[model samples]
Target: METWKEPQTIILWIIIVALFVIILLTSIIFLVRTIFKKIIKAKEKEAAIQLDYQKNLLETTIKTQEIERHRIAADIHDGLIGKLTALKMQQEITSKDQKTIDALHESITVARRISHDLSPPLVEFTKLPELIKELLDPWEQHLLITTIFDIRAEINDTEEFKVQITRLIQEIITNTIKHAEATQMYLHLKQTENYMALYISDNGKGYDVAKNSKGLGTKNIETRVQFLKGVYKVKSKIGKGTSNMFLFKN
Candidate 1:
């Protein structure tokens, strides 16, 4: 009986030790998991804050640029263009050189064009389709541009929105002319009750979007798209062509 009791006691002690070890390991694992989760959450929070700061900085910089552009346009229209006009008038009256008058007239036209490009006047009051036509008419001399407009809903028509849209389109056109060795361009605008869409494509020598580094023009397009809370996608192939599609809330 004594031998049996000793064996039973030994078996009980073994079981107790096993239970203690299991509990200890479980507690350690739980603590480690908790620490890891806390670290992850902290990192995520920091990333979000940093992103907001960068976005705000970008917004401020863009607004400042627009303000400066407006100021410069005003100066060109009110000061330089005015002076050019007066000079042209004086030349017409005093100079017999038709060539001189023609040159002065040309200078005034160039100044006016620059001023208009810098800041379009009464943009908010203009219908978007009309404004786009006015913007693209001058470029017709450079490339074959085809446009299609389908409107079924009222647009925001705010000055800021229109200006951003205009700038975005301008940037895309400038990039195509400078880089794409293509001749024809297409623009299609569509609007519904819920959203507006813009499609622009060029029959130019397209580059691989993944391989090429984005230039300042691309960055500016991204910034303006973000400002408008719009989404855009670009597709291009080496020898095919490039196309950009943008969608915005109406």
Candidate 2:
């Protein structure tokens, strides 16, 4: 049978071509899979970046809200407190009861002074350090609190921000005396070329900052910072103390 016609050399060539085609297709599939994987990784990275940006934005918003609350607090302390104290004094004077005259006068003076201490428009007229000292003086005897202020450089001379800063300081000081159960506190004001920083630290029985669910004061502070486009942070250690920082851009 003529050695089976040598199995046809052309057929052998066709078989080789078919094998080559199969190999080529397999390589192309692998290449496509790799490209798809790379695309998926890129998308995942992009999503992560977006998530981080959103988180930062949310934090900033919360801080702004805190600032607003403090501003309102300051306003009430400044405007309403003084007006009410003045009225109280007037009422006492008109009572015509000489027996209580001395007591009434003393009480009215105390109230008026408290009002002034709580709400100082010193931002309109004086430097921040001086205003801070005047604000804390009244409470020193009551709390036995030690306050230390460290100023690295002259702070921003901007007038509009002074009132806001003073308000912030007052709030923190009140919180420390009323809640922190602390006997000592330290305040540091630092001035940089681009930022103004305030550090309020208290040595007291500290509490958890994260576990606060209904803390209006905390929320208020956070909001105000955000409103001013500042950085706000509260660091507290149980049984140790608490440190709060506010950094505003100049």
Judged by TM-score, which candidate is best? 1
The local distance difference test score of each candidate is: 0.88, 0.72
Off by over 4 Å in 1: 1-15
lDDT of model 2 at position 81: 57
Candidate 1's clash total is 0
Q: Residue 159 CA error for candidate 2 (Å)?
A: 3.5
User: What lDDT is obtained when candidate 1 is compared to the true structure?
Assistant: 0.88
Tens digit per residue, CA lDDT, model 1, 42-108: 9999999998998898789889989999999999999999998898888878875789889988998
Structural similarity to truth (TM-score) of each candidate = 0.89, 0.58
Error of 1 at 215 (Å): 1.7
Worst 10 residues of 1 by lDDT: 1-10
